[model samples]
Every structure is written in C-alpha cells, then in structure tokens.
Target: MQQYLFFSRDISWLGFNGRVLQEAANSSAPLFERIKFLSIYSSNLDEFYRVRFPVLMALANVPKPGEEVTDHRGILNEASQLIARQLDEFGRILQEDLLPGLKRHNIHLIYKEPVPGFLTGAVTDYFYTHVLAFLQPLWLRDYSRKFFPENNKLYLLVVLTGADGAEETAIINIPSDALPRFISLPYNGTQYILFLDDVLKLNLANIFKHYTVTGSYSFKITRDAELELQDEYEGDLAEKIENQIEKRDLGLATRFLYEPGAATRTIFNLAQTLGITSSNMVQGGSYHNLKDLSSLPIGTYKELSYQSWPSVSPKDFNTGLSIFDTIKNRDVILHIPYHSYNPVLRFFNEAAIDADTEEIYVTLYRVASDSRIANALISAARNGKKVTVFVELKARFDEANNLKWSKRMKAAGVKIIYSIPGLKVHAKVALVKKKNNNRTEYFGLLATGNFNEGTARFYTDHILFTANPNLVRELEMLFIFLGYRQHADKYPALQFNHLLVAQFNLQQTFLFLIDREMQHAQRGKPAHIIIKLNNLEEKRMITKLYDASNAGVKVQLMVRSICRLIPGVPGMSENITVTRIVDRYLEHGRIFIFHNNGDTELFMGSADWMNRNIYRRIEVCFPVLDATIKQQLMEIVQLQLNDNVQAVQLNQSGENTEVTNNLPPIASQQEIYNYVKALQA
Candidate 1:
C-alpha cells in the first residue's frame, strides 16, 4: 500500500457542493430550477460552516503529542482557497449566464438608475411603509462596546461626510428576516425586481435626515457555531445544552464577507470591531445570502421551473385500507418522493386507530414538528395502548424540538425514553403488537430515513413493512434494550439469523460475510459484493474490504457521501469501484449484497457503513426475505450502476469524474421515478 492516498472529507464535501453549482450553471436546466439549485448550494455551504468548520477548529486545538497535527491547518487553507475560486465561478455564472438568460425572457433585476417611472412610486412607498420599521442604525463611535449582531445576518455600512469633510460610519441591519429580500415592480410590459438592500440604499438620505451619504456597502459575518457543552456528568445535561445553544450565537467569528469595492479603512475598522482577524475575512460580490433567492416571487413563469411530478403510490398498496393486513400478506417496499410516503405514515396511523392494537414501540431520531407519526403515537396512548417512544434528543439542529415533542408525548401518557447516555438512537423502526383471537401478532417497519414527513418529499428512501415473526421478536427485544431493561446477554432468544443488529453483532457479522466471500474467491468460486450507503468512514470496515479485494473478491460500492477509502488502487483495491449519484432527489437508502458461492444474500436497512452506525448506534439490517423484493433491490442497484448521466466516479485523486462510457445517457432518478409511475399506471 503506497502510503494510502486520502483526502480530507470536509474538502470532498465541498466538491460535492460544486456539483450542485454545476447544475445551476448548466443552461439545460429549467431557469428557475437552476436558481433553486444555486440557493440550495448556498444554504448547504452555510450549514457546513456552522457545523463542520467548528469541528475542524476543535481538532486543530487537540494535542497529538510528538506528531505534528498540521492537516487541520492545511485543510482549512485549502477550503478557503477552494471557496474563493467557487465564489468567483458562481458570480460569473450569475452575471454572464443566468442574468442575460432572464433578460431574454423579459425579466430584469434592476440595480442602478433608469428605474421605471411607473413602478418608482410603488417601490418607494413599499420601502417607507414596510422596510423602515426594521432599520436600526448603530454608529461606529459606539463600537468596541456591547453590540451583538446575529451571525450570517446582512448589514449595510453607511459612510457619511460633513461639509468640513469629517467622516462618520454607521451600520444599517437589513431585516431580511422580517421582510422579503426581493420586491417586484411593474414595468412597461416587462417585470422588474429590486433587491431590498438596494431599495434601502436608494432612499438612505430620507432615513438619516441630517447626514450626507458618501458611500454605502453591504456585508455579512459567519460565526463558528460549535457549541461548548459542559461535561454533563457534573451537572444537568439539559441546562448545559441550553447554555451552549445560547452561547452559539456569539461564538468565535469564522468568516467576514463584504461587498466588492469596500473601502480599505471601512473593511479594517469593521473587521476590528467584529473581532475578525485578517485570515477570517473574505471580500465578495454585491449580494450576500443568495440562498434567499429560492423564495423570490418571479411570478408563475411555468416555463422557468421544473414540471411537477406528483408522487405515485405503489399499485398494491391502498391509502384507505389497513396497512397491517397489507403487510401481513407480503413484504411491501416504499420508494419515497417518487413513490408516496403516505403508506408509511398510514402504517402508524392505522395501527394507532386499530382497536386490536395492544402496544406500539418506536425509535425516533429526527422528526418534523407537526409530525403525524407523533400524533398517532399520542392517539395510541390515549386509546389505552402501551406506547413507547425512544426519542433521540441529540439530533443536531433538532434537539430542542425533539425535547418538546418528548414532553408532549409523555404528557399524553406515552412512555418516553430519552436517548441513551452515550449513544444516539438513530434506528428508524416501529414494532406494533396486536391481539387477534386471543393470540398476539406483531408487525414491524424498518426504514433508511427518518419519520419526517417534510423531508420525505425531497429525499429518496426505502421502507420495509413485514409481519415476519422472527424479525418482530428481535425488534421487541431491541426496544427492551433501548429501555435499558435488558443487557445483550439477556436476549439470547433474540439471535438474528437474517437481521444485522448493531452494538451486538452487526460489525462481526459483516466481517464474517466478507471473509466468506474472500474464502470463496481463494477457492476459485465466483465472488462478488455490492454495497450502497450514505457514507463509508469506518477504517476497520474499509480495511476489511481491502483485504477482500486483495483476495480477488470484486466490490462495487455506491456511496453518496464521505467516502474515506481510496478505491481502484493497484495491488490494494484493484477490484473495487466507488460511484456517487447526485440528482433531483437525495439517494438515502442502504443495501448490501454478497455472492456467497452462488447462494446470494441481500439485506437492506437503516445502517450506513459508518462507525457510528455499526458500533455506536442501535441499527438494524434485515434480509430481503421476499424473492421478488430482492430482485427489485437488485434491479435498482443495476440501474444505478448503468447510470451514465448522474453518476460520478470517485477517482484515486478524490475527484468526482463524470463517467464517460459510450452507453446511452441514463439519469437513474428520473428513470426510477418513471419506472414506478409506469408500474402504477
């Protein structure tokens, strides 16, 4: 192994964001849809700074004894450079490509003068009435005192000069949170839009009343969002978390972005007051927070947006019927966004309303505030059913909401289990028990995504509903473990023959299976493996795959994010190939296939090939017992493998190179959606 080639996962993630930017730059995409992609890219980068950048800073502070920990510094420098390059590209595309294209369609984004006379009154009146109330001006003389501006909030720096040339500067906070960013105006047979910041700039003299505005520019700051959680072992965890969330707003400043052509003195003074060092400042174009463009009301230009494709429910599944009876008959798989997620929601709703249901147990990682699943669980508790919900309160950006829902469920008589002290409960599962003719029956659901209804519309995932007794028994035992009532040794009867349960046997089982393939390869039998997951960051697992590859076992991986392994390396991973697919819907399913000397084994579930999923979280992976479902999964993987349009190969240099095979172009997401739609038709 020639020094094991690797790239920082953070930088690799930026490259993935570059793909979204590519979509925005591609003229073939619908005009408004391309704008939406650009907004998504911007928003995704914001969260990256908030969440991941702080982690890198923390890593830089950790001591590594005699070894130099320079990778963190190098990674941050590379990220800063890459972002500068991409921002330039983004600006050029918007100005040269998208703006001109919009002009051809009779749409204009007015910046400087030559305003339409008819719309001037409307724009001025709207700014005076709506935008004036939110403006709070802070003078530079009052700086170096207590002033806390919200992170990532936009502000306009206004510099004024008196008759004697005495200069003073003040900051005008743009209340984008309180008002719309873009204001549309009526033009002569054409539509025009003015950015709210420009509207303010156009009328700054009226607001100041006394000062002559020499120059004004817009700027924004990003803060390090890393929360410093106190060691909860010494005190109340909830209180500590609350304190940390409060301090997050005033965390260390990470980046200070300003409009181009900002005066040198103004930038230096603003950076000093904001506690921003030279290394943390970035100067950019006129606009900040282009992510807000997603909400721009450019009217119903049908030709400028993607055509709506309604979600199609599976042909065999009925929305108005009992889901338990449907699942009892056979296994049903749901492909979300393309296929309706209502069936999975219905599974919980029907169970809650069903008179025979005795008990309901579920593990929730992330859920929406207005969660239908949570409401159903509350209803089940109200109807005298034993309802147990293991809510993970550690879900990032959702901890407070989860805590609120946990309290609500407990108040509704549902037994609420807080997250395990050390581990996050990430499994998406529900086990329902019912009484039929004096006998107890169980039905379970396993999924690759959360029970969040809002995300289900844009994320592609899989849900398996089954009445298999063996799996149901294991699920029941797992819930007991979550409740902290039983240890691993107490669940001998819950031995898994077809399910891979994390924290007990998942890692070992996967290693055993890989070794089995390796032995078969050595014996000259046909040996192959196919795995699909969101991330592959477990070092041991990657090494095991390398071991298998060295034994002549072929590996095909479809990883969507954070792949730490370098595939296709000579003598080490020559037989391994890794591909990623980025498209309209997020690919979030996890599947594993092994060619075990002709008798293939296929499994699908919530666990990714990450360390957290294998040994830290309670996850479950069940075999595709139904032969038809197994074939369906196989076909899905095959379609992805054959995809020449959206699939990108993860090369040895960690570059996402578009596959250039001579096959006809196939975009898998569209094809899969059409495939399911045709099935319903």
Candidate 2:
C-alpha cells in the first residue's frame, strides 16, 4: 500500500496540524485565542513526536528494496492515523468545545472529576507552598540508577495497594519543570484553573508517606530529538556541536505519552524500561505537556486573548537616517509583522559603524540569542570591516544557537564560514563594502526572514534594503559563492538578470513564470497567478501549478505551510485556489504574482517552491524592483486575498475549509496591521 505520490510529509505535517486544529476549533476564535490555538496544537504535537516521529522510527529500521525509503511504515501508519484523527479532533475541541466555551466566558478549567470548591483553598495552598517542595517519590521497588526519566518530562505512574493484597509501583516526578502548568485559583470573580496535573493529582498523599496511593497515572516521554552529527568525526566543528548539545538529553525513546486509563501493567513496565515499543506506546489525553498551552494562565480574560497589535514602524522608514542613506535612496520593502525589523537591524548596524564601511558579506540562516545581528557582526569585526560570516551550522533548532554564535563570531575576528557541506545557505544575503572614492561600492541586504530580530515579532518576513549597484554586484557574487572563495562555475559576473537564484535561476525562473501565465491562458489574455508561499511542496512545483490550472491560469494560493497541492481538482485544479492564513501574524512573506501579459510580474524573496527550496537551499528570488515596493507588495497580496477572517479553504480532500467568503470580515493579520498602520498615519 505504499504507492503514495505525495501527502505524507508526515501526512502533510498532520495536515498542517489540522490547520492548527482548525484554529482550535474556531468558534469564531478569541477565547484565549482558542486556547492559543490549542496551545499551537499541543505545541505542534510535541515537536511532531519529538522531531518528526524519530525520523519515522529511524526509517522503520531500514533494509528495504534499493533503500530510498519513504514508506517509514507507511509514514508511521499515516502519522499515527493522522495523530488519532487530530487527537480526536483535539478531544472534541477541548472536552466538548473549549471547556464549554470557557464556562460561557466566566472561565474555568478545573478538570480531574469536578474538584472545584473555589479551587479547594487555592489548590491546598498550591500543594503546601509550591508543589510540596518539588515532589520526589520513587518506589518501583526502589527505582535506581537515580530514577532515570527526563525527556519531555512529566511522570506520575504510582499504583500501590498493599495490606497483603499485593501490588506496588511508584514514580511521581511531574514537578512540571518546576511548577506552573496552569494554577491561578482563588476566583470569586469566577475564573479558576488548576491542572498542574490536578496539582500533582491532589498532592498524592503528601508524596506517599510510606505507600498506599492506589492508581495515579499522568505519563510523558518523547525523546529521540535526533541530533547526531559527529561532524565527520570531529576535529572541532564547534566541538561537534557542543557534543551534540550534550548528547541531546540522551535521545532515543521516541514517544510514550500514556494515561488513557494507563496501567496495562503500567504501560508494560514503562515500555520495557523506556526503550518503548508496541509502536512507541501513545494512549495519551491526561494532558501530557499540552505544550503548556503556551503559557496558558488564561490571564483574567483580556477579551480572551489575541489583540495586542503593535509592530508597524515605517514612518517613512527613517529611524534617524544613515541606514546607508536610507537604502541609498529607493528600494526599501521591510514588511515583517508589517514593517520594522529595525531596517534589517539598521542595515547591519549602519554598516557596522560605517567609516565608509569596507567589506561585510553575511549569510547566517537564523539569529537571535543576544544577537543585535550578532552584535553587528561583532561590531564589524571590531571596527576593521572585511567580515564574511556564513554560519549556518545546520540551523534546524538553531544548532546549539548556531554553535554558540559560531564561537562568538570566531572570537570576534569574524570570517567564520562553516556551512556548505552539501549546501544550506538559505540565502538571506548581506553584502556591504563601501570606500567609493577609488572604487568598491555595493550595499544590498535581501531577506524573507531571519536576520531574526526575534523572529521579527511573529515572522511575517520580507527585508530588502539596497544601494542597488546592480543588486550590489549580485550580492558580491553571492558572497563569492558562499566563501568557498568563488567557483559557482567561477561566477559569470554572478548573472541573475533579476535574481531567482537557487542553484542558479529558481526552477527556470519558476517555470518561466508559469509559462508566462500559460501564454496568457492560451491567448485569451489577462491570465493571473498570485502565490505568497510558506510551502506548496514541490511536485514539480505542484505540477506546474497544475499546468497553470489547465491553462485557464487564475491561480491564487497563499499557502502558509505544507500544501501538497490539490486545489479544486475538477479537470485537475479548477483554476487553482488555496488559502490558509492563521492570523495574529506569521504569514512569512514570499509573494510571486505573474500576470505578465498584463505587465504584472512582481516577485519576492527567500524562495520556497520547496524541493529543498528549489534544488537544495541557496535560495533568493528577488524582482519587486520598487514601484513603491511593487505597490506595497500588491497591497499585502490584496490584503491576503481579502481574508474572511484568518482564511483557510485548501480543500480537494486535504480539508481545511473555513473560508465562508461574504467579504465584510477581512482579518488579514488585522488588515495588514491596519494597512501598515495607515502607512504610518
């Protein structure tokens, strides 16, 4: 049954976490933003069972025909049956619709079988002052080796039953990483709360004062967060990524979960002492780290969350000048969470304290851990320019904070490369160089995300900035082919007529602009295309946008995450459509548009037509060439195609639906942050 052509990128990332459990079962969101979208769908299913279900259970123990293996047990039994039908539609939208719509807004969450006499004296004074001094029970017959357990935390287990009837087991631990898994009690104003696993299940008889508790449960395990780079037998690739981040907390037990009336012999003796089998345990639902409902204290209902707007910053983009004389006077874009990522960290802190700057370069795939853009490239390598950087030491989960900011930007002398071993520069480009009198001009910046001013306040990225000397000589020939010191076939003057890049010319410039909008929909003229990606998943660019939607070409799309193309599908994608917005920021810009015959050919950066961003990583994209930043990115993609409140649609069986378009509801990230705050008023 493994003939799957697509739709198993972990079941399209659990159908994009069931479109984030349809925005936490959207009952017109806002009720602690549907419990912060069910705590980001239980923190994206606990990092998809800790990093993609242990790489599909280590590719279901290999040994297959020709071994290009993709059926990791049919994508882990269709990602554990689409994560048990999205955790039974996230437990019927959190126990029959958001705990009865947060008790009709008076808010309440006290779960474990009704224990709510105004939260029993503030959960018995928070279990005698902060969870009985960090609980410590052990007894599974004197559990040794310092009682193991410490991945994805939480524990409980118990079972006792002595007095000569026979039975014993113990474990406890759940000091929810030292408290606060939702406490807030004393509420005469009617709010209440609780579940620090029912405050350690009503303080289990003050930590088993010599046994007989009966049947506690809880559970959690997760592990296998896969980070095994020996750095090609290390010579010090940042001490082999700081010794695989200290052996990534002893990685290996992938997913145990439990507490669905647990105790099948305590889930088979804790899955045979945590080596976990029977297809990695699971049972679930007594709330094992519901990704701590992303700090769900439900705070006395600030109109049930999701409101705070602030992030527009473009008073004509001039936070007191010299951002290289305002991108040398023209092309400026910026747009993230509607604008300010402080002009891409003030264009590298004003060209690292510009004294006619000199040479900078940059690439860094991700940043921010005390990064004022890595302290302005370590203050422009201590004011002696000619920098370099690259850095992407495998950026997934920011490889130990980019190997501790690449050994503090290589002890502040700066050069640093460490990336291209099978390419992953993810092009965010930088450039700089100055000293003009006797030559050397360049300036550039280009981005799409990650010069990370803390994920530019919720990721709707788009940088740009330019001095435009032919795009700073094609971004100094892509930092001389990412500093392998030239040899992108010895840079033919880094020719990128107008940049699409990735392994040179993003998939033949996006299949020659979707065959110029399928030759203007076969000469009927005025064809269209739009785009705005985050992921469309590359099936030859979704079968060339389903052959420009069977040559009628009115595409659309907007895809914010893993869309394995399947628009309307009548005659294969009825003139395509797609959607998926998920509000409160994070649409992470990519743009595209193409009605070429109608002179609408715009483009935006940091590519994502996938297939590892167009044939393996070094992405770029470009061409918005500025007619007031292409009419401000076509008015933020026509206000996210007139969002009927946090969009959705994507159908053709990959259901996300929810876009009842009548048109008066527009919530494209609060109407493109009030149309870029009314263009800075």
Candidate 3:
C-alpha cells in the first residue's frame, strides 16, 4: 500500500485565493464584479498577513518541545512566492483587463499615472480643503519610537532636503480612514477617480514648504491580530476579551509592506528607526492598500456589475401563517440569499411578542452590527421571557461587536453567557420554548452560518427549522451544558444521540459513520460519502476518508476554503474527488451525507472538519430527520457536484483545475435558486 500525504493548510488556502483571482481574470465576468474579486483577493491577503502569517512565523521561529520540526522556512518561502505570483497576475488583470474596460464605459481611474495636468489646480484646491485637516507629518528620526502606526493603516515616507541642506525623512499618514480612499473629480460626461494616496503625493510640496520633496513612497504595517488571554478560567472572559481588543492593533509587527524604488539606505534607515526587522520588509506596489478599491465609485454604471436577483420568500411562511405554526407541523429549510431571510427574523420576532413563549436560547458566534435578531432577543427579555444568549467573544475580529451587543442585552435583563473558558461555542443553534394548552413545546433552528442578516444576503447557507421532539430536547440539553461553563468531561450525563456536539460525541460519531460506510463497501453494497464544508484540515478525518476510499467507498467533497486532503492519489484516495466553488455568494455550509446501504444519513451545522472545531470548540452538527427536507438538501448537493461553471476540481498537488465537460453548464447557485423557485411554483 502507498503512503498517504496531505497538503499544507495555509498553502491550500492560498490556492483557493488563486481561484478567486481566476474569477478576476475571467473575461466573461461583469467588469465591476471582476474589480470586486480583486478587492476580495487583496482583503484576503491582508488578513493572511494579520492572522496566519504570524502563525507561520511562530512555527518557524519558536517550535514547541516534542513537536515535529519540519521545513517551516521553506513553507514560508513557498507562500511568499505564491502570493508574489498572484499579485503579479492581480496587477496584470487590473492594468490590462479591468482598467481598459472601465475606460470604455467613460470612467477614468487615476492609478499610477500622475494626476492629469488639467485637473491639478482643482485637485490641489480640493486637497487643501478636504484632505489637509487629517494630515500629520512627523520626522522619522525624531519620533520613531513614539509613532505607533496602527495595523493596516496607510502611510507615506517622504525623502526631503531640509532648509539646512541635510537629507531628512518624514512620515505622513494617509487619511483614508477619515476621507474616502477613492476621490471623485468632476469631468464633463466622464467620471474621474483618484486614489487618496496620489492626492497626497501630488500635494506634498504644499504641506512641506520648507523642505524640497525628493520622493514619497506608500507603505503600511500589518500587526499580529491574535489576542492572548492571560487566564481564561479565573477572570471575567468578557472583560479580558475587551481588554485584548483594545491592545489588538498594538501587537507585534508581522509584515512591513512598502512601495518599491525607495533608496536601499533609506529603507534600511526607516526599518532600523521603526524597530522593524529586515525579514518583514516586503516590496509592494505604488499603492499599499488596494482593498479600498472595493469602494471605487462606479457611479450609475449598474450595467457593469451583476444584475440583481431579488430574494424570494419561501411559500410556506409567506402564506400569512405563523412561522411557529409552519415549523410545528413539519421541518422547513431555507437556502439563504436565494430565499429571503424574513423567516429567520420572524422566528425571533414572533418569539419576542408571542404570549406562549416562555424562554429563548441562542448561541451567537458573530452577531450583525444592527442585528434585528439581537433586538428581538432584547425585547423577549424585556417582555419577561427568559432569554439566554451565549455570545462567543473570541470570534476573532468581531470581539468588539459581540461585546457591544452583549452589554446592551445584559442591560435589558437578558442573561448573557460569555464564551466558555478555553473554548469557543461556534454552534449556530437556537431553541425556543413555549406553553401550548398547558404542555411544553420546543422549536429549534440549526443553521450552517451565523445569524447575521447582513451576511445572510451574500453567504449561501441553509437554516433548518424543526419541531422534532428528539432534536429539540437534545438542543435544550446542550444549552444547559453550555450554561454550566464546564468541559464535556465534567458533565458526563450530557450525551447526544440526535445531534453531534463537539468535545463530546461529534468526532467519534463521525468516525463510526465512516467505518460503517467502509463495512458496507466491503459487503459489496452501495456505499458513498458526500460532505461539504468551508474548510477541512483534521488529520484523523482525512485519514478516515482515505481509508474509506481504499475500501471502495466513493467520496465526493465540496470544500470552499482550506482543504488539506490530497485527492486523486493512487491506492490512497483514487476514489475520492474534491470540488471547490467560488461564485457571487460565499458557499459557507457544512453538510455531511453517508449512504447507509442506500438509506442515506445527512447532517448540517456550523462545524468544519478543522482541529479547532473538533477539539477546541463546542460545535453542533444535527441530523436531517425529515425526509422531504433531506431530499431537497441531497438534490442541492448533487447540483454542486455537477457544477461546471464557478467550480474547480482539486488535484493531488492542491491546484484548482477547472471543471470542464461537454454537458450543459450548471452553476449550482443559480440552479439552486431556480430549483427552489420552481418548488414554490
């Protein structure tokens, strides 16, 4: 038997981003959509620098005892090279494809070129009026230590000759945070856009009148975003997390991205003065933060972007019947972005005002800024219903928003449970208890994504509404266990037969299911596995999939982000196929299906197959017990597997090879929308 191998998770993630770049480079995509793709790629890379780059740096520099030390530096170099190549393609697509396409539509984006001489006076006057107030220039040599540039904030370093004829350097902060990154200029019948950086470069002489401006280069520093809590078990987790959020921008520098063509000595001096090591210094383009391109003023040129597809209201709930009534009689599933999110909102809103509702329980990993659901929860608490909310403050980059909502809810008489010590409750489940005719009835929602309405419009996910007694009872038990704030081992009575709760029976049940499939394959009965997740990185699960493949159990996987399993490997994973899809909507669901001798078993929830989900967090994956909903979900997965457009196959080397065939094109997102609409019809 040949040995099995796995791809590096980080490198595989970069390859996923490369597929995003492919969308940007595709000529068939709408012009503005292509620009949006470029923005996504840039934003994704910035996050990699902030979050994952630090992990790679730590692994290479500080290895733990007994940990297998591999060539981490080599992996780092490979990542760097891959990003460099992607950035090159990014530049090419912008310059060669997108910019010209914009010009054809009478839009002129002033990129690297100097501001047109005809508009210099207008821009110079506008700059002094609109952009001058936010400028703060400091001499690097005098204030290097005191100047703490915030993470991912843009700055320009200027080389100038002082009045005394001595060479000097000063740093000017780009006020993109305050002012618009892309400024619009008036031109007859044509729209003109300028990067705020170029506006600063053009007007440097006005700000530094005493010094001769020799050159200016744009740069930004990306800091590590990981927050380390000193003690999780002993203190207020919410207060500790709030403190950490305050210090997040001040963490160690991870990358120093600077424009090329700066003098070598000047770069060295700047690094030394700012306490940045040479290894973190990376040569970037003339503009440091292209993520702001997302806001490019594509004024009234709606034709250049994707045509809108109005959200459809599901038929059952739109019939003027109560949402609670619809769920009580049968299980219902809504595919978001295709189906309107009103049902989910109404589920909470009704529970708030319903006379029978006695309690509401929810786990919020990431809450929307102006969440209607959170507002409804507050109302429920105010109306004398027992509302318990588990707000996971450790949801990175969202700690502040979660804290804000948690405080408001607590003030409104809601019982707010902060994150579990040393664990993140990533489950997207909610339970509502009501009294009907003196009998207790429970309604629950198990979803594949967050409860954020804003994200619901762009993330393709599934939310299951069920009144199944078994599932709802198990959900109530899980919430009770969460309220205790103890590890699963401490609460031995908490066992789930209907739902798969991580840190308890989730991993073992999944393994057992895979082994069962292997047994079926050995018996020459029908056997296969179909799983979809945002990421897959757990070694044991991947090994089990390989074992199933060797046992003749066909495996079809839809992993949207980081996938480490090397597919199509002879004698190991030859029977397994991996597909990735990136479209207008983010594929964010986790669905697992196993052919139990042709009577398939399906589950969907928030957990990925990553180690953090399996061992470090309390994730919940529930079985699809209803036959009609199960059939619909199975059909959706089949559509995704059959997708040719917006889908790519992953090879053994983790490259995203395009899926091609002679059959008619089937973009799963569009097809699913049509399928759901027809079902309503």
What C-alpha lDDT values do all the predictions have?
Answer: 0.82, 0.77, 0.92
**TM-score of candidate 2 against the unseen true structure:** 0.34
In model 2, which residue pairs have backbone atoms overlapping below 3 Å?
569-573
Model 3: how far is 464 from its true place, Å? 0.7
TM-score of 1: 0.94
Where is model 1 more than 4 Å wrong at Cα?
Answer: 1-3, 58-70, 111-118, 230-240, 319-321, 485-497
> How well is each residue in 98-131 modelled by candidate 2, as lDDT tens digits?
8888888776787657576656666877788878
lDDT of 3 by residue, 586-627 (tens): 999999999999899999999999999999999999999989
lDDT of 1 by residue, 365-455 (tens): 8879899999999998999999999888678778778877888999999998775655667888899999999999999998888989988
By lDDT: ranked, best first = 3, 1, 2
Taking all chains together, each candidate's TM-score versus the true structure is 0.94, 0.34, 0.98
Candidate RMSDs in order: 2.7, 24.0, 1.4
